[model samples]
Target: MTSIALIEAAAQRLAGPARRTPLLSSPFLDEIAGRRVLVKPECLQHTGSFKFRGGWSAVSALDPEVRARGVIAFSSGNHAQGVAAAAKGHGVPSVIIMPSDAPQLKIANTRALGAEVVLYDRANEDRDALGAKLAGERGLTLIKPFDEPQVIAGQGTTGLEIAEQAAEEGVSRADVLVCCGGGGLTSGIALALEAKAPGLRARPVEPEGFDDVARSLAAGLIQRNPRLSGSICDAIITPQPGDITFPIMQRLCGPGLAVSEEEALRAMALAFLRLKIVIEPGGAVALAAALFRPEAVEGDAVIAVASGGNVDAGMFCEALERFGG
Candidate 1:
């Protein structure tokens, strides 16, 4: 269980290492959403995602002896880069098992960060088994991408910052939209908001085909995505919500909202054009919901966490070309 105390502890550990991403706003986006919109560009964070906060929290919190043995994690891209960089900064070895089909930039970045990159077939293989095998063989700690208490606590630090930043911006009541996958970031933010910014609510946003969190929240039960891959928002696609994270979201978070792939791309282009930030598809989903699903959201203002920016050149060019107006 990740509580405010745990999150505060993680924040203490992440104090100097992780960047405190700014909460930005664009008049253009505000006009489109028909309300004030604030964007938390975690894309500007280390490793190009907010995952670094969790990565540094998890890696740094480890006992010195265990951390020295190294760590391993499995991610499509963002989390892989985060953990790899954290491990590198900590002067420990890391092994990242990424999907073979993940963006080339993420794979290359992970390797550049000094992690052993192992590509796996996301559809046919189980990352848990592979990660376990590798950890056992190399005496490495397995830092799960989500569903871990420490990781969630680390991510919850974002919520803490949002609470503070929103206050500074005079945003006391608004929907804090977060991009959802295994529910790590969403759930973590929800917990933090509940404690630090009760007036501000956290909501999970997902891509249309992979709306497991939305459906699961509506149905009051866990739901799985039929397909494993094939969306441009690969960074935030997961089979289902995590057992640990789902309940927290269900309790503390608002109803989940989902948008289309096109909507995500459009939001990406808009972010690039207005905020001058490059947001990947998965990372753009929250902003997509804020812009395209305005009726589904509440309040006079909305805050979207631009979760990542580890996009490839071709896809980024496509987004800018098709929707960059």
Candidate 2:
């Protein structure tokens, strides 16, 4: 199926559960950029991230027999909560393999949603192999975090909503800035935006250390990270883009941009103070890119997807201090 069809299917599948998050114009950012800046606050989404949209769509699309067998997933954080929460809603069992260094709050949240959590060391172990083994042993289907079509289509719903919301507000078209991890959200959003508003540009933003998507898009191939940079924006720190998402992103996304760790933290603080929204470091990268690279998006209305709000309290305080809050 096409990206539009997938988005429609995801909308239908997640109709009742997933929140239709609003796209509100940010007066503060607008003043700073001298153009209308809208914020798609998916941090307010169920499970504190947009991952629920894809997770629910994937599970709900399954045949009854498959659903009965349950599902398994591997995630560092947000995706785990999404899959777990969706599984709970569907009355299906779920097992999530997460990195041992994942945030405690995310791990707890996943378990609280009634999914079994398995921790693995990301540095030394192959999470995919472990997840597949667990899935085979338990007779469960493995739901990939970002590489699956269902997941991508589900994530595309954000773009659909952005387009609809922008039109509703009398804004014809706007540049969309989305944070990239494995390219699922960026690729999906780009497709949705292309369909919804052909003139609109979709840009993927990444942290300085995790610029695999940006680099790969420029080089016209998938590239691996030589070494993970210890950026505060951990959510978008994937080592590489997914096979399913890379080609789509190459076609749909404009030139990608990278922001520094300090800039990301400042943007996070700005979102909390000015926008009154709690955004994690990763989620704030898009806004940070806009702030640091204004010339690239100058004179165009922009929509930044603040993807999640699951930050450790200590990190939040540290971000505030770093940004002079």
Candidate 3:
């Protein structure tokens, strides 16, 4: 099926479960950018992120036998919660491998959803190797965090919703900005928008230090960064985009953009203070791109996907201070 058809199916399947998060207009941002700016607040979604849409989609597509056997996945944070929550909803067992340094709230939430949590040192251990071993030993179906087609289709639901909402608001075409990690979210958004709003431009935004998607798109090939540097947006600080996701992005998305940690922090704070919404650093990257690089989005009514809201209280406070709020 075409990517748009896949996204439509996902949206239909997930409609009953996934929250219809609001398309909130940001006057402050619109004034700053000299155009209309809307935020797709997926932070308000179940499990506090857009990942829930893809997780549910993937879990629902599993064979009955596989669901009976359960599933396994590896994630730094949001996807762990997504897999765990989705598996729980389907009455399936899930095991999630996470970096030892992953946020405490993410680990707690994953366990709370009844998933067994295995922690490995991200800087020193291969989480995929550990996850694969556990899945094999336990006879569980492996659910890759972002690389799989099912996961990508599931993520596309976010784009479908955005397009529909914008159309209802009388927007003919707009630049849709999405945050990128392994590229599932951005690719999904691109595919959905391309299908639903033919002329709309989709752009992937990444952290400055973790610009794998940007570099890969520029080189017209998948490129891996040997190491990931620091970013306030830890959720999107993946070393590279997924192989499957990279191709889709290269075809559908505009050139990727990278925003600084300071820009991300400011965007997050802006969402909380001005928009009265909670947004994690990764989710705020799109808004940061709109704010810091207006030239890229100028003259277009832009929709920035605020992908998640899960954040530590300490970090949220620090972000506000950094944003000069």
lDDT of 2 at 107: 83
Relative to the true structure, candidate 3 reaches a TM of: 0.94
lDDT of 1: 0.92
Q: Best-fitting candidate, measured by lDDT?
A: 1
How many clashes does each candidate structure show, in the order listed? 0, 0, 0
Task: Write model 1 residue lDDT over 1-325, tens digit each, in one string.
Answer: 7888999999999999999999999888999999999999999999899899889989998999999999998776788888998999999999998879876776878899999999889799998899889999889998888899889998999999999999999999999999999998999999999999999999999999899999999999999999977998988999999999999999998999999999999999999899999999999999999999999999999999999998888899999999986
What local lDDT does model 1 show for residue 114?
Answer: 95
User: Any runs in candidate 2 off by more than 4 Å, and if so which?
Assistant: 121-126
RMSD of each: 1.6, 1.7, 1.8
Query: Candidate 3 — worst ten consecutive residues by lDDT sum?
Result: 1-10
Model 1: CA > 4 A from native: 99-104, 120-128
Q: What is the C-alpha lDDT of each candidate?
A: 0.92, 0.86, 0.84
Query: After aligning candidate 3 to the native by TM-score, how far in Å is the CA of 252 from where it should be?
Result: 1.3
Candidate 3, position 303, lDDT = 81
Q: Where does model 3 exceed 4 Å of error?
A: 121-126
lDDT of 3 by residue, 156-254 (tens): 888888888999878877788899899888888888888788767788898876888889999998888667766678788787888888888888888
User: Weakest 10 consecutive residues, lDDT, candidate 2?
Assistant: 291-300
